[model samples]
Target: MDIKDLLQTAIYQAAHKAIADGVFADHELPQVILEVPPKKEFGDFATNFAMQAARGAKTNPRVIAEAIVERMNETWMEKAVIAGPGFINFYLKTDWLYTMLADVLTQGENYGNSQAGGKEKIQVEFVSANPTGPLHVGHGRGAAVGSALVNLLKAAGYDVASEYYINDAGNQIDNLAASVHARYLELLNQEIDFPENGYHGEDIIDTAKGIIDREGDAYLAFSVEERLTKFKEIALQEKLAALKADLASFNVYFDVWFSECTLHQNGALEKTCQVLKDNGSIYEHDGALWLKSTAYGDDKDRVVIRDNKIPTYLAADIAYHRNKLERGFKKLINIWGADHHGYICRVKAAIGSLGYSPEQLEVLIVQMVSLYRSGQLVKMSKRTGQSVTLTELIEEVGTDAARFFFIMRSLDSQLDFDLDLAKSTSNENPVYYIQYAYARIASIFRQATEDGITLSEIDHSKLNLLTTECEIDLIKKLGEYKEEIIDAAKERAPHRIARYVHDLAGQFHTFYNQCRIKGVDRDLQLARMGLALAVQTTIRHALNILGISAPEKM
Candidate 1:
């Protein structure tokens, strides 16, 4: 159970008691929603339930709050005070913190685990960038955010699956084939006109060069259509392989790799459009099939099929999303680049047309990322014939720092990544600072071993010795782990865990400076060691969810 859950239960019982005892007339009760106060003086946690229930109870908010607090008899809380506007601020006794530290030590890495999601199934599809080129920084940001979110949802006890949708059946593939063929002909010293608006990345030249080395001039003997078809197949396999490898290097792995080609095959796209028409969510105009998206709050009706009987990209997407629904995914989460913002409404409208609630599909848009070095923006040139590739970013700043920096900020905001800070060893680097905290704890254990103090067993009674301001603050931060995971998963925000772990590290740093373990009394020494183990467990657990590592030796 979450710490907040326990607090809420107590507050609820108190409110009901106040009603049963006739302290206030009860028509209905509002839910107790607690928030961590902005300042410590406001107490450990605060709730505005009194304000919400004031009108229903036919009383002032302050009177309702006072009634509830007067009846809140939970021994875990030291006191509850009424703040301005009838907010109830709760200050907890240290006894609960001591018990929580024991649990943290016992549970270890599972300290932050919870069942808040109730095992509800969800699918997260991200970085479905076309295989025509290498993944760039935009895709990298999505990969980092998407993968971390999957990990977080699972931690909060969701039945989650991560997926990568391969955009292999489209104009992009044709352009790739034509570009590779042109590059191949050029490598053979033959006069060739490159396909206009084709992929101009240097990776295309590399692919052509690789094909020639393996097959030699044998492909030249085939007809244009046959050779181009072969290039399409071989190039897709190679490009997809490289894409998977690059993502793997960043610690992002997908459970499923769905192909767009499958949606286009076997009359799937047409069948989906027919379903929309059957539901009266689609119509025809000007010899083209159109989706009545505007009826569902889209800017306007969108074209699904052209007059020439060819389906547009929107048609494929509609079919693809329907397939996801048919596969029993209760929820579908798509992580798209910022440019796809306008498409959200149409996609949701397609969901409603298919007889499903548009709310079932959640689209997370990852904004742009700008790299900086030495206080100047690190300009991206036509590297790999495009912006910075994911591989280049990983090689430059390392996987851990790159992933952390990408995830530390909210997804909806533009991120300015500092290249020099990521590469630096100073405390200003958040990743370095976190890992150093873990190392500092490990160093304490090493020193204790030399001093012949062993944590063979924890004295449950000695846990009360952790009474200093620093120790109490660290315990409070550690106690927040489960609550943090619950809120982060519910809000669809993985950055919350990043912030929580950073603050936990900060708390431990303060504790280390103000407290000593090796020279303390034997009983106190063992208690502090137990606390230290909890800190180490939580840091590693939180970092693992972010796909970052907590090193014992900085």
Candidate 2:
């Protein structure tokens, strides 16, 4: 059970009893807000219920606080005191902590999961990068954040679908085709001018060579137009395969790889524009169709179809979102790069104009990531000459460190990924520090078994022996696992889980230092062992949510 929630309910009951007892016959109790005190001397948890009910009581808050404390029937509270401004503080008895430890051990991997979301259908679309190049560190960060958010939402009982929108129908694809053709000509000693906007990565040249190995100058037998189409088709397939392989290696898998070309082929864009016209949200001027997005909070009107009779990218996006809503999802969440911050208003406006509440769509902007090695910025990728690819970063540091570091900070804040620190196995590495705690607990269990002690023989009744400050603090932290998961899911923030695991690990280390398990009295040793097992179970569950591994040996 959530002790804070339970205590809040008890406090409300006390206030009700005070009202029935005629202490505040004229008052209606306000909602109770429970908060942890900054200092231990203040209490375990503090609430402002009495202060909020003062107006209804027509008396000073301290009077109401005293009345409620007198009527309180909290069996788990050691004591309750009134602080300045009538804040009620509660110190919990040891039974609550003991019960929490048992709960963690019983729940095991399902410790933090909840049914709070009621299984609302939600779709998270992220890392929809163009299929023109390999994914960079920025894409990697987005992938990590998106995947972790999916796990968090599922743990909170939301029905979620993860998607990647492939951009394969635009000028970028044409440039890719031209670039590959240029490389093929160069390989055959035929002079050709490379397009200025063409892809220059070595992977493009490699793709061209692979085509030559298969066809062998057969492309010369066809017209340049046909060759361009063939080349575009070949490059798109190859790039998409590589993208899928790289993301899978990083442990990110998508339920859907939605294609932009499908939007045009199926006439979804035209259908969406017609819907906007029917709603009078679109107008035509100068042979171009424009959307009055400014009517729905956008800074300015946006063009849906240009003078050349071609639909803009914005047109396709609107259709995509409409498709998502029509698919019966209650909410749509998009994770975009920080550079797209200005794009959020227009998208939300479009959704609003499509007759849906703007609040139905949520956009999260992932800020840029800078890589540092030995205190110096690593500017360019040796392969692409633009930015370091995600594959390179994963190869340099293992997948665990790469995924952990990418989300170690808030999504809106700029992140500096230190290469040297990530590779270190020492305690300075946060991932290693958390994993080591799990490993240490495993070592203790192994040693115990060797000494002819098994968990089955442990005495759980002696748990009250764990009254040390460190031991209590560790159990209290374990109790917060469910709340952490709920808060992270509600806020759409995965970094909170990472921060929680680190704090839990720190508490376990402190408890290990202050308490002894081996060679202690039989009852005391078993109690501590049970606590250790609970800590291990909780840490593993948290790491699984973050998409990080909890190793038995680090």
Each prediction's RMSD over C-alphas, in Å, is 1.6, 1.6
Error of 2 at 156 (Å): 1.3
- Judge candidate 1 against the unseen true structure and give its global Cα lDDT, from 0 to 1: 0.90
How does candidate 1 fare on TM-score? 0.97
- For 1-554, candidate 1 gives per-residue lDDT tens digits of 44677899987888888888888896778788988898988989999999999989888999889988888788788899998989999998888888888888778778888888999989999999999988888899999999999999999999999999898998899999999999999999989999987888888999999999999989999999999999999999999999999999999999999999988787889899889888888888999999999988988999999999899999999999998899888999999999999999999999999999999999999999998878987677545435888899988899999999999999999999999999999889999989999998888888888887766767877799999989988988898889889889998999999999999998998888889877778888899898888998899999999999877787
TM-score of each: 0.97, 0.97
Model 2: worst 10 consecutive residues (lDDT sum):
455-464
Maximum-lDDT candidate: 2
Tens-digit lDDT track for model 2 on 348-394?
Answer: 88999999998999999999999999999999877567889999999
**In model 2, where do residues sit more than 4 Å from their true spots?**
22-30, 55-59
